[model samples]
Target: MLDAVVVGAGISGIYQLYRLRQAGLSVQLCEAGDGVGGTWFWNRYPGARFDSESYTYGYFFSRELLDEWSWSEEFAGQPETERYLNHVVDRFDLRRDIRLGARVSAAVYDDAAAAWTVTVENGERLRARFLVTAVGPLSEPYVPAIPGLAGFAGVWHHTARWPREPVDLRGKRVAVIGTGSSGVQVIPHIAAEAAELVVFQRTANWCTPINNRPITPERMREIRRTARTIHRTCQETPGGFVHRPLSVSALEVGEEERRERFQRLYDAPGLTMVLANYRDITTDRAANAAVTDFLRGKIRERVKDPEVAERLIPTDHTFGMKRPPLEDGFYEVFAQEHVSLVSLAEEPILRFTPAGIQTAARHYEIDVAVLATGFDAVTGAIRRIDIRGRDGVRLDRHWEAGPRTHLGLQSAGFPNLFFVGGPQSTTGNIPRATEIQVDWVMDCLRHMADHGHRYVETTPAAEEAWLAHVESTVRGTVLEDATSWAFGSNVPGKPRVYQLYAGGIPQYRARCAEAVEAGYTGFVFG
Candidate 1:
């Protein structure tokens, strides 16, 4: 039996393995895909890139690794991101312990033995003292139950499960669905090549232009020189990134000054315009409208047709509430002669014909349909495995109402099991969040070892309090107003409750620190 078994060979799992080995534990990782890079590995869709700057989006544990590997772009694309992860795996020599193309089917705790027996799809059973699920929050791809989808003779693909070889869209008619981050990014690229591109948007999304540019060698040198400072900045911020600090609320600024500030952020790169520029963009309605109006104006200005522009404007939710997507020429892409925008809200898709999709309004013939529909988010991947805890209590039944996680790290009934960057945690910059959770798990394990304890799990009472705390943190925020994936609202029949801890990363870190100082107050060890 191994000391620990980790599920999912993404960045989180990679770090978990690295740290576990450092602690002199025997650990093994199983991945569903054929390689490392978890989400990046599966999501090879065109135009997929990090919203956060490349420098701020990587692992923070190794300075040597940081100094050695270099990024080619400020906002790295999927290919580059995959390359970086592959580099990390090679640099750390982490492949020997990782079993690729092995998807975990079930993990059941042996209460008497105080261990877990994990079963994979390949009929392999592995026993471990502790099971750590590093399976990504956005790992599960969601395909909507559209009627007659199987009837479509044309090729269809989900963004999450895009083929390794590029799909040839040039001179081909393509239909794209969903206007979330991935859809927004993919549309522009598709519009560039597709002979006729039709976009099916269920809801319009808030999008800001990305100031994407190449990272020069000189810039790399400067980053290396002040690498410590950059890493420190990441730690100090709420999100694990360095960007514009909005000291005053949006209402505090004068009209001209507000426009100027918005303009400056709009001109700048990454998430500055929506997430970092205004303090009250997500909190206060009036402030959010101010930013919303500016973004809507930008969209209207870019797209030539007023009706099309209005169709693209999102009025249902507050700005920055639904995860705002950063884009390049996304708004402008609609103006292309070959492009057409199909509003699903206006005309719901009835079914798919043998040749194409048939909406209530009309049917459009297309060679390929790409479903950029988002994932099942945090809880989906975990529930995919038949995880049974105390007395064989199913994880699905436990989370049937919604996910209940103490600090998003452990469930109440599951002993000797842990989750890294799981649901109900402050899930911002993923690598940073992963580092925090992995470090905490290591600390908890060490504490258990030092105390001669064998079992650890969150108490029901503690789990309840944490869930309450999560609700309180996100109660009045814009995140609560939307039917977005943030609230598990994207997938039909999924619970409408807020599943993510909306509290800032810094605050979450402080709370985690307090728990450690107070003997991991939310958890119980035996």
Candidate 2:
């Protein structure tokens, strides 16, 4: 039996495999896709790019890798990110251990042996002492329950499952449903090409400019020169990525100063500036209102039609609560003569016709349709696997109410089964967070080895405490009030729990450190 069987060969899985090997453990990673780069491999949608800056978006374990690999842009697009992952795999010689196109159907723990039997699609079974699920939180694409979707004569695709070939949108009438991050990113690109573009918005989202640009050789030299300082800054910041954190509350600033700051942030590249600049923007409703109003004004200025601008402006949730999209000309897309906006909130989608979608108002004919709807998130990917633990307890049945894990790493019944980037874990600067998680999991595994422990699992009490702590972290905050995929609000019938840990990276890192210092507190080893 292998020491561990890791599900999903994404960034998390890749790092986990490396770390496991370093610890002298026999490990293998199974990826469903024909290639590596899990999310980047699948999501080839137009305008798809990383929200995090390119420099910090990669693995931090190897300084050699850091020095060798260079990013082309400030924000790497899907292709570039995928290429980077491929490079990492090639550099590490990880392909030999990874079984691509091997989709794990189920994982069941055998109490007697203290090992997991992982069954793949072709009825092949692999035994492992431990099961590490690096299956991403946002891996599962959520298709909305639209009636008569299959009957559509025209071609349609979800942004997550876009075709490998370039979609010919040139002069074709297109309709994009849902205006989340993917929608926000994609709408601008297609708007330029489509003969007529119709965007259906359920809830208008807050958008910031993605001032993406090429990274110069000089920039890379500067980064390499100050790599230590940059790494330190990344760790110190609340969110994982290095940014200018808010030292002062928004309420403290004067109207003119605040407006100017907001405008400057608006002009700046990336999604975090406005939200991360002011501490009170996410806390105080009035402070959030000020930022929202400024953004709304900017939208009004960008879009020519006042009505269309107003329709695009979001007032439902406070800023930073929902997924903040970074895009250039996303708001301005409504101003294009060929593009039209249809607010689903104003008039709900009635049904889908063969030609196109039909709303309460009218039927809009389109040659192609794009579903930019997001994922079930956090628990979806993990739950999809038929994971039966001790006493035949299924992970899905256990987490039926919502996902509950001790430190978002290990569940109670699932001994020797671990999760990275799972529910209740911090997703701030995903790669940074993933590295931390992988390190933590590796440490725990090494501890098990040193102690002669065959089985390891978190106590039920610990899981409860962690779940409660996670809920408490978001309680009374603007994040708690917002209904987005981050909180499992996008999928119908999914429990509306705060899946991600709201606690900043620094605090989370410290907490994990403290737990390790206390001999891996709350975990039972046998």
Candidate 3:
């Protein structure tokens, strides 16, 4: 038996375990993977890296950890990010309690036991007073329904489940499916190696330049000096990433002024336009069109081939509604002699032949197919496991409509069960949200201990009300215009409701504070 069992070894899970241990709790972190890094640990495609700036996309809890670890690029790649996470684990000596390669198959709470009985796939059983799920929002790999994908004779891998051994695509044809963030980032790198690369893209997202460069000693120093300010700025800002701090909405600005602002921010690169577009894009369809049109034009101008460029434009959805993708020289890769953009819309992939994939338009032969198809997002991780609470109510059935929890942490039926960076929390950049949420969970659990509460859970009524609030919050926003993982629209038959609180990080932090002030509102203690 342990005080807490965290069901992930990702960054959030690492933070949760470290904080809980610091709070005098005995914690055991079980991970399905053999090692740490969670999503980073797994996603090892060519050129997979963090799009968000590295200096900010990291843990803020330990100033020492931040200062001690160094990044290879302005935005750290997957390998370096994983290395940093491992470094933190070693620095804190946090590996003693973490059991790797042990996938938890079931976690059930017996009312009489007042503890969670966790059963692993290997028949190992453990009990814990508190259950924390650090399964990331983007943890689950989602391969689209491409026919005969299983029978492909050559190499096939998802970015999420990259092979440990090196893959050789030197003179072989390579096809990459899904041009989302992963595809955008990896395509150029893959195209450089593949004899000929075909990118089968369904939708074209607004791709911004990474503007990624090596982090200088001078730059690191400046960021370290202003770490507090950056954290504050991110908390106050709409997106988790630190961008323009805006007090006024853009709708209030005159057309000329707004266009000028848009021009300036658009040139600025990566998420600048998001805050600039914050004014009326969600409310004013014209405003949304103006920005989307600008992006479409930008994408069109980048590709060498006009026909290919036209196919890349996202006609249906507004910008930023779908998780905004940021990349460098993505469209330019199509100009390369080795690269070809396959329009999945016009010529849908019919099936995969034994040799390679085939579309209605052509029978292209390839040695490898890289599935950049993103995760099932928010709910997939939790759904992968059997979680039962209160009278053996299965979590799968409970979340049939969508995930429901108070403050994205504790579920109503499962007393002592906590989730870090889960549904109903900020889904932008996670490191920032992880810091705030971890702090709150730690403080809440401490409060429970101090008050001599043996058990605590969200009230059923409170969970329903909170779920409704999450759904309603995005109703008026531009997110409703299309299917996004944030709204659980990307995955087929998944609930249409959003998984994040869309109310900005500051408001989320404030509500959490208020909940603590109000004795953990929407929750009950015994």
Candidate 4:
């Protein structure tokens, strides 16, 4: 039996495998796809790019990797991102231990042996002393159960599961559903090529300009010089980003000054508008409203039609309550005559017609339909696998009310099973957050080995306390009440619970360190 089996070849899994192997453990990485790069590998949809700065989003574990690879764009697109991950794999010679196309069907823990037997879809079973699931939060795609979807004559594809091969949208009338991050990114690109484009927005999201630009040689040199600073800043910040919110509240400034501050943030690149704005934009209702109104006004200015502009503006949630999309020419696309917006709130999608989509108002005849419907998120990927722990208790059933874990790492009764970048973990700048988690997991495993521990599982009391802490951290924040994917609201029948640690990187890191310092206080080892 191998020391550990990591389920995913994504950012988290790749790093976890490398760390485990470096520690002299026999580890294997299993990827569902035919290749590496997990999310980047699958999300090959039009206009797929980083909302985070390319440099900040990448791996910072190796100084050599940082110095050698320079991002072409401020926010690198899918192809480049995929290539970067492939480069990492090849550079580190990680391909030998990775099993491609090995989708994990089930993972069952043997109580007597204190080991896990992971079964792949191909009927191969790999037994390992420990199991680490790095199956990303957004890995499992969520497609709405619209009637007559299978009978639709035209081609349809979910944005998350976009084909690796080229999908020709040129000259064809297309309908894009859902106005989440993926929808916001793909719509503009589709409008540029498709003969006619119809965007069906369920709840219009708060979006800001990405302002992506090429990284010049001079900028690359500067980035390399300050790589250490950049990484340090990322670790120090709340969201694990180089961007940090100002200390002063938005209410402290005058109306004109607030508008000017919002404008500067609006024109800025990536998530600066949200992450680097005033401190209370996400917490205080009045402060959030000030920023929200500023954003709404910007949307109105971009779209020429007043009615269309209002339709695109969100009414339900504040600016940062739901995760906003960083877009390029997204609002401007609605100004184009051939492109149209269908407010699903006004006329909800009834069903799928043979030609295209049929809403409550009319039938949209289109050659293609793209479901930018988004993912089940957080727990979906882990829950997809039939994971059984002590006494054959199912992981899905255990988490039916929502995910329960200590530090989003280990659940009670699931000894030797850990999660990286999954539910109840850090929320922002994912790679950085996952890096922190993977390092902590590595440290935990090392502690286990040093202590001659064969099995490690979190105590029920610790899991309960952690869950309570998570709820308390987000209790009064805008995110706590928002009905978004952050709380599994997008998926029907999924329990609506706060699924991520919103207390920032430093706080989460300190808590993890405390657990370790307390001799892994919450965990029981055998």
Predicted model with the maximum TM-score? 4
lDDT of 3 at 271: 62
Query: 384-499 in candidate 2: lDDT tens per residue?
Result: 89999999999999999998888888999999998888888856777777778889888888888788999999999999999998888888778889898877898999888899
Model 1 regions lying over 4 Å from their true place: none
Give the poorly placed runs of model 3, Cα more than 4 Å off: 245-260, 276-278
What C-alpha lDDT values do all the predictions have?
Answer: 0.88, 0.87, 0.82, 0.92
Write one digit per residue (lDDT tens) for candidate 1, span 1-526. Answer: 9999999888889999999988999988999999899989999988999998888888768889988988999999999999999898888888888999999999999989999999999999999999999988898999999998998999999999999998999999999999999998888888888999999999898788899999999999998888888877877776778764688999998989999989999999988776577777888888888988888888888889999999999877757787788888898888889998989888999999999999898889989999999999988999989999999999999999999988888888999899986898846677777788899999999999999999999988888998999999877877667788878888999988888777877888888899999978988888
Q: Assess every candidate by TM-score.
A: 0.98, 0.98, 0.96, 0.99
Ranking by lDDT: 4, 1, 2, 3
Off by over 4 Å in 4: none
Residue 504 of model 2, lDDT score:
74
Question: What ranking emerges by TM-score with the best candidate at the front?
Answer: 4, 1, 2, 3
Tell how far residue 86 is off in model 1, in angstroms: 0.9
Q: Of the pair 2 and 3, which is ahead by lDDT?
A: 2
For model 1, the local distance difference test gives 0.88
